[model samples]
Target: MVSQLDNPNLNLIPKPSHTVKGLIHIFTTAHRNFFTDVMAQALRIAGQGTPVLVVQFLKGGIRQGYKNPTQLSQKLDWIRCDLPRCIDTPHLDDSETASLRDLWEYTQKVVTEDRYSLVVLDELSLAINFGLIPEIEVLEFLAKRPPHIDVIFTGSETPKSILDMADQITEIRRSHTP
Candidate 1:
C-alpha cells in the first residue's frame, strides 16, 4: 500500500507510530541541508524521553572527509553530547574486512554504549555499493535496532529489502518538468 503526501513530487507519508522504531529514507540527489532539517523536525515528534537513532548515509567524500561528526553536533545542537569523534573510522573499512555479525556487534556496542537519542548513518548506500561496507551487516544493523531507538537511513540509493520493511518512506527528487 503506497501513499503520497504534499511535497516535491515525493511521498511525505505519516509515520504509523509516534514511537517509530526504524525509518529508511531514499534521496535521489545530494541534499544534505534539506535532509538534516527534515530529520530534526521528525525527531522532535518522537515521544518524550524516547531515544532516536539516526543512521545517515553520506555520499562521495564525506566519509573520507570525516566531517559529519562535528557538523551533526552543530546541526542538532538542541541535543547534547560529549562530542566523540564522529564517523568512527573502524566501522568504515571494516565493512570490507569484517562480517555482518561483526558489524552488528559493533553497532550494538555504539547504540548501547552511547545510549544515543538518534543514530544517523550517512552515505550508507554508497558505502555498501562501493564495497566499503557489507550489505548483510547493514541489514543486520537494521534488524537488531532496539525499539527504544529511532533509526534513520538516508542516501540516493536504498536496498529493496530496506524499502520493503520501511514504516515510512521519504524520497527527495528534483522536478524535471517544473
Candidate 2:
C-alpha cells in the first residue's frame, strides 16, 4: 500500500524483493492497526524465505488491540524487551526495559552477521525519545547496515534523522467522532 506523509509531495510505498537493497521503511501513525500493517507486510516477505528479525522496544506484551502474529515462518525472529506474563496477570515493572546497548548489540549482530533480510524496529523511536538508547549509535548502525537488508520502523515520535534516512515513510492519523 502506498500512502502519503504530511509532505504532500512525497509518497511512501514499500517495495521489496530478494534483490532489493538498502531499503528503509518508517511506519509512523497514531492509529492502532499498525500491527496488522506490520504483520501483513512482514509475513508476506518472510514467507518468501527472506529472514526477518523483529524487535519490539515497548515495555509490554502486544498491545490489547493488536494481534501478535505467530512466528510461523522459520525465517522470522522476534525479540521483545518486555518480560513474559500470563494473560491473567500483567507483570508490571519499571526496570524490565532492555538497555540501549543490548538493543544495539542485537541490531548489530543481525546486520553485521547478515542473519536477516528485513528488520522491524517496533517502538524504537520511543526508546530513543526516552533516552533508553543512543540515537547516534542507532543511526550509525542503520547507515552501515548491509545493502541487502531492509528496515521497517514503527512507533510514534519518529526521530527526524530516521525520517531523513528512510527510503519511504508513512504516517497514519487517528479519526475522531463528535
Best by TM-score: 2
lDDT for model 2: 0.71
State in Å the error of residue 85, model 2. Answer: 7.8
Give one digit per residue, the lDDT tens place, for model 1 in 16-110: 66564445444445554466655665456444445444443333222322222333332241221112233323354434334323433554576
Clashes of each: 20, 0
> Cα RMSD to native, each candidate?
13.5, 12.8
lDDT of the candidates, in the order given? 0.51, 0.71
**How close is every model to the real structure, measured as TM-score?**
0.52, 0.72
User: 24 in model 2: Cα distance from truth in Å?
Assistant: 0.9
TM-score for candidate 2, please give it: 0.72
